[model samples]
Target: IELAEVVREVTKAENKPFKPMYDWGDRVEDKIFSVANKIYGAEAVDYTATAKKDLARIYELGFDKLPVCIAKTHKSLSDNPHLLGRPKDFLVTVREIIINSGAGFLVPLTGDIIRMPGLPAVPRATVIDIDDDGNIVGLE
Candidate 1:
């Protein structure tokens, strides 16, 4: 609820239209690269060629107005995951943009992002167990 209010405030403050999804289209990659370069001195590589065919196919199907969801490491604003904790001196290299037409978002592949979420070293499921009385236990 707080997030929703914040979004409302931000939208009103910015005076931007509240679109369900934002579509930057072909210029999305360049725009992001420019911003990164300005802010962090990072360089974004263009690997759109690899996904060119797929993107073209998506466009052919007429789903070109979808907003891009950039897939990058949360560890750093830059693409490099190892460069954690707001390091400013690094290049952000974008390898490709994977299109999810059905989901209506373009995933910009940056650095070494593992698309799959990995399990913790000690998974909680392992620690979770049931008591002899059938009550749930070990779920702190």
Candidate 2:
């Protein structure tokens, strides 16, 4: 669904509109959702019927305070970046689900993706340095 639509639903449920946020390349982690919205043509997509119904039920069960976890690929919006823009007949294979009691939420792992990512072979830290005085410097 469109980002605006998702925000609207959340607002209707929570009684307030959630602020919009976007992250460009600087923060790779935060931009995936925006990319999804762009790829899916905003408002053209929706969560799986089963997932949506489950979320609604959870909300009805006095779980408004609980967290919402979006299960998606850690890769590009197309699930496979090689194929861009709203892909049809694509299948998201969810391997497992985990519940975080402390966090009061459910995690639906949709694919083999890493939450904690490791740097590439040439680490950015290689060029970073901290002096004895605590001053820091890195690639410009």
Candidate 3:
């Protein structure tokens, strides 16, 4: 179904917004450990040498104050994508961390993850065209 069709056919849509549940305190290391170990139920969190250096840089740059946006595979709860379902025992290995101060968040790169490209059956760009008046159309 199209976005509009799905919206129109939706039975119940809650107004409740997301609220962060777990917090291991203000430290960046604590934040990552909190997300990986506490939330994802990881037995432990292993940080790579690059990640260690990144953390040091982040702290030096004072971007460590920002919230963490952990990047991991959608295929599994753990960082390992091939783990499937909810694996009982696993480690969340943070390969590297990058900060976008303008965006105000720290992205901790975990495992081998890729961006989610939402390719639809009918691409929205295919329907987009310029009207007679030179205004864009089919954007909605």
* lDDT of candidates 1 onward, in order: 0.66, 0.49, 0.83
Q: Candidate 1, residues 58-121: lDDT per residue as tens digits?
A: 5677655566666788777778767766666576656676777668676767777879875889
Angstrom error at residue 130, model 3: 10
TM-score of each: 0.51, 0.34, 0.65
Candidate 3: stretches off by over 4 Å: 1-19, 22-25, 115-140
Q: After superposition, how far is residue 99 of candidate 3 from its true place, in Å?
A: 0.1
Candidate 3, 22-104: lDDT as tens digits: 44247888888788876788888889999999999998987877999999988888998788876865889999998878888
How many backbone overlaps does candidate 1 show?
A: 0
Taking all chains together, the TM-score of candidate 2 against the true structure is 0.34
RMSD of 2: 13.2
lDDT of residue 58 for candidate 2: 45
Give every collision pair in model 2: 1-45, 2-43
Summarize candidate 2's per-residue lDDT along 64-138 as a digit string, tens digits.
343435456544454444546556545443344344557875554444555556479988889899879998888
Q: In model 2, where is the ten-residue run with the lowest total lDDT? A: 23-32
Rank list by lDDT: 3, 1, 2
